[model samples]
Target: MSKVKIAVIGCGSIAQHRHLPEYAMNEHVEIVAVCDIVEERVNKVASEYGVIAYTNYEELLADPEIEAVSVCTPNYLHAPISIAALEAGKHVLCEKPMATSSEEAMNMIEAAKKSNKKLMIGHNQRFVASHQKARKLIEDGELGKIYSFRTAFGHGGPEGWSVDGKESWFFKKNEAFIGAMGDLGVHKTDLLRFLLGEEFVEVGAFIETSAKENADVDDTAVCILRTESGIIGTLAASWSYVSKEDNSTVIYGEKAILRLEEDPVHNLILQYKNGEVVKCELGGIQTNEEGGQTTSHVISHFVQSIISDTIPPVPGEEGMKSLQVILAALESKETSKIITIN
Candidate 1:
């Protein structure tokens, strides 16, 4: 196929602001279909992108023209929809959190393996330039023996980002399956795993609804994670940052402390033990609280994987590993004890 025919299965805020726009810009991709339970939304998105709109995602998935499909629906539907798309012989680019539970995520991974299709998770945090640079720095051994790291992702709330505002599915336990932890914490877990190149073996967490008065889901959470390599760190996710968003990571090392997006002006900063500070401004981090998640390289990588017939950098199995950490965190919080990732 000269161009990959693609369909976006959710015409919500993320599909509108991120996936659709990115697909429009990708020359190798053709936006063939758009689907949503909301007919009005599906129509609007299809009209805007000049594609077919379907009220049911299954109808869109049945179309033989579409070579790939972006599963941008609610968290609970992620696994089922992505698995269906893969079984239909279409590559799937699923939105983050991957799924509500590790079992669902594993199902999607297995489906992709059985179908021999590309299954890329939309974990945009890993595609940011600053994060890429940080990963490179750590890989190059500039930070020496890494002692520990702290990563945080905070914003106002999903009320400000979701299409339905306060009534969105994000705040409902039945649909969302998780609160801020799944929304933002999963991203941090994925990023830490990517930067450190290790899997989290255990997790201890404190999850509570400290803010967002109208929401049933958690607004703030703090997780203590220990990786397979014996590295420990704090991963926090919050929707209570009324002042500003703090999507930053600081890695403590024997030689230096590397900070990513800690400074508003500088994208990265390396503070050495011997009184040396190196500041570098590469590009802006692609994560956004107000539904503006542009300037991300995730779509490009997904498309490249299709064109090259190569595995995506963040494939189904990779995303599943990240989701497992958050799942363990959830289990730990409920039990009031540390949970091990077996």
Candidate 2:
């Protein structure tokens, strides 16, 4: 293993815009394969990166030389592919939401344990500099007994972000499982968990396909969460914002009210009760074609975890905690009552 030979298991927008570009930045990584169900996409990304391409993900997983695989596929396929990769003795970095359902997420976690291979979820928000700072502030007790937080991750629509335009798999429920919630909501849920440092104990939420007039899944959703430690919060996700709004996490504590993404308003902001406001810019500031290359940060973390035999920051079970919150939200939306995580 001169260098960690990695394979990308999806050639979609995320692979192109984030993962692959990030891998290119890491001197210790050699991206050996790019896989996708779509032949053209696989070939296109492979050509761009000068790597082998495969229409079948299993083919890439079969490659013994690939020490790790980044699972960038649709939400529905995440568990299956990552589990297979782990079983094949390859470290895995799975995209967020963790899985379409908590059961599936647990299966992936079990597979990682059985194989003793590293499994890291792609909760990139945790990697952002601003978020890292916020986590440190909270852990240091600067906020002092977090009471509540509100956050959101919304955009114009998947069409604007996906290479497939309106026809993107994001619009397909079978491929995406749940639309806006699974796509954007997961990010907020994971971020909230990361910042609060607690698992959600109960959730009550509402979901609707009010916008994106032609979509089958939810275009908007709002959820309320109560963490195990008595912290409360609201999380929102949508594909209807005219201008992208990725703002998030306003934590109110006994000593301070921390507002994230508050100035320039695109960046994270922290406000203290003593009337002090600290602003910090986010990492991976994508101002150009090279902006998304920081995705390698997450990949590098996964590789380091593998080499050191340490659990990943966003490990499978930890990711499952986030997914369980989402699933509880779904249950809450359907039943019109707060659902508990346990």
Candidate with maximal TM-score:
1
Candidate 1 lDDT by residue in tens digits, 91-148: 9999998998778888999999999999999898887888899899999999998889
lDDT of each: 0.90, 0.83
- Candidate 1 to truth, TM: 0.97
Off by over 4 Å in 2: 265-268, 281-296
Q: Backbone clash tally for model 2?
A: 2
Q: Per-residue alpha-carbon lDDT of model 2 for 1-342, expressed as tens digits?
A: 577899998888888877888888877788899998889878888898899989988877888899999999888899999989999999999998789887898899899989988999988778777778889999999889888888887878888778898888898888888888988898788888888888889999999998886688888999988988898888999888776455566889998888776555346666777788777666533321333434536777887787777999899988888888888888998899989889
Worst 10 residues of 1 by lDDT: 286-295
Give lDDT: candidate 2, residue 107. Answer: 92
Give the runs in model 1 whose Cα sits over 4 Å from its true position: 289-293
lDDT of 1 at 249: 97
